[model samples]
Target: MRKMARHKDVSPEHLPYRRCVGVVLLNAENLVFVGSRTEGPEHTDSARPWQMPQGGIDDGEEPYPAALRELYEETNVRSVELLAEARDWFTYDLPPELVGHAWKGKYRGQTQKWFALRFTGTDSEIDIHHPAGGAHPPEFKAWRWERLERLPELIVPFKRAVYHRVVQEFAHLVG
Candidate 1:
């Protein structure tokens, strides 16, 4: 079974099953941040699709904090002013291959808690290598701001459906 973190203030029953979190960062131009994954040897020369920053929640971590952490780790962007957060969690099942070996039996996939944040800081604030903290060393090699409505078409296939839903739910912020 996948070990999921539960908040101290909330009971497990109240939390979404297999919870994760994602950050949707919007700039003043109303463009959303999108990133290209570093090309692997197997995918060399192939265009890597873009995605918003996201990741799993750690034990005892809340969704919003996880979202902020992922944003910094993935894009080197921070100081986000949160605009909104989903009232309910969105879920998608991971393909079997994507599941960890120990979690295959209990989990069908992941349930994600999402947040929308406006970038209040200048572009200079984005540092893919700030020493304060972040997730991985940065899996993304390149990034740019794109129209929110077009994100569903630009992201990887696995994330397309959720991106579509997120766009719809947060369309008000885009305009």
Candidate 2:
């Protein structure tokens, strides 16, 4: 017989997932928005830190607005038009090493609703150095437009599943 044991004090299954919203901003060239995460645990992987803009869902917020809010908050992009929403919510778990450490120990990982939007403005409008009227620090140091299919390769492994699903769901809309 085999047995699986879990920590009683903080079992992985008992931890709540963070509710988050993800944004996939697409430009006229059919490129998707991606950014390099500027924050995480000191020893976190730097190689695959690039990701789409995402953030926690505030209390009493709807997913669509949250997605747009996160987009503006992270990338200073507000000239976008709603394109599509993912068919369903997606989730991923952080490695045990990250639990109790990431997000101030508030979540095991994130359950996210992703939104796709078309950029109706120019590249010069993007300012990762300043976001949401400068009310919050930027989450990314650099940003770029990439093919939608490349997202899984750029994101951290823990969140790759969601990115892969996003790519699959949005692939038909890509050029």
Candidate 3:
């Protein structure tokens, strides 16, 4: 453990990526779920702050369950069925400005397991105003269903590459 701690403090590049799960919720209309972030005061100049539902992977939790839990926690929408899973996990790095500030400075970025889900319920089921599935407040201030191809353009810049990969990997399922 001492050796690991020493390596951990070595440098930012040596820091591990946070384990996470990301989901793309698709409706019959083939639209992807997107939510506008409730940005902090410091992010007033952020350009694209929208993102899909996502969250950390709790210890002992598998990616699929984590994905479902995160989706519900962030959106309060449970009427979904797994449509597909990505062939591989995707990762993204936080910019230098965010590296030691995100996740309470525990991680350099995130290594994510991505899932695609199909919504089986009505729009009224989504309650972004007050998420019932989580102990905390909703992560999103507003929500919308958007074109799958536009995902790469909707998220924060650092996350765009992963979105592009997801869009490409799940292209066949979208339409």
Worst 10 residues of 3 by lDDT: 1-10
lDDT per residue as tens, model 2, 110-152: 8999888999999988989988778779888988889899889
Give the per-residue lDDT digits (tens) of candidate 3, residues 17-109. 999999999998999989998864213235687889988999999999999988888888889999999999899987766555556667878
Order the candidates by TM-score, highest first.
Answer: 2, 3, 1
Alpha-carbon TM-score of each model against the true structure: 0.76, 0.92, 0.89
Q: Point out the worst 10-residue segment of candidate 2 by lDDT.
A: 1-10
Cα-based lDDT for every prediction: 0.70, 0.84, 0.82
- Over 4 Å off, model 2: 1-9
List the candidate numbers ranked by lDDT, top first.
2, 3, 1
lDDT leader: 2
TM-score of 1: 0.76
Give the clash total for candidate 1. Answer: 0
Clashes of each: 0, 0, 0
Residue 42 alpha-carbon offset, candidate 3, angstroms:
10
Model 1 Cα lDDT, one tens digit per residue, 28-94 = 9888888776642112223446877777798999888888877877767767898999877887754
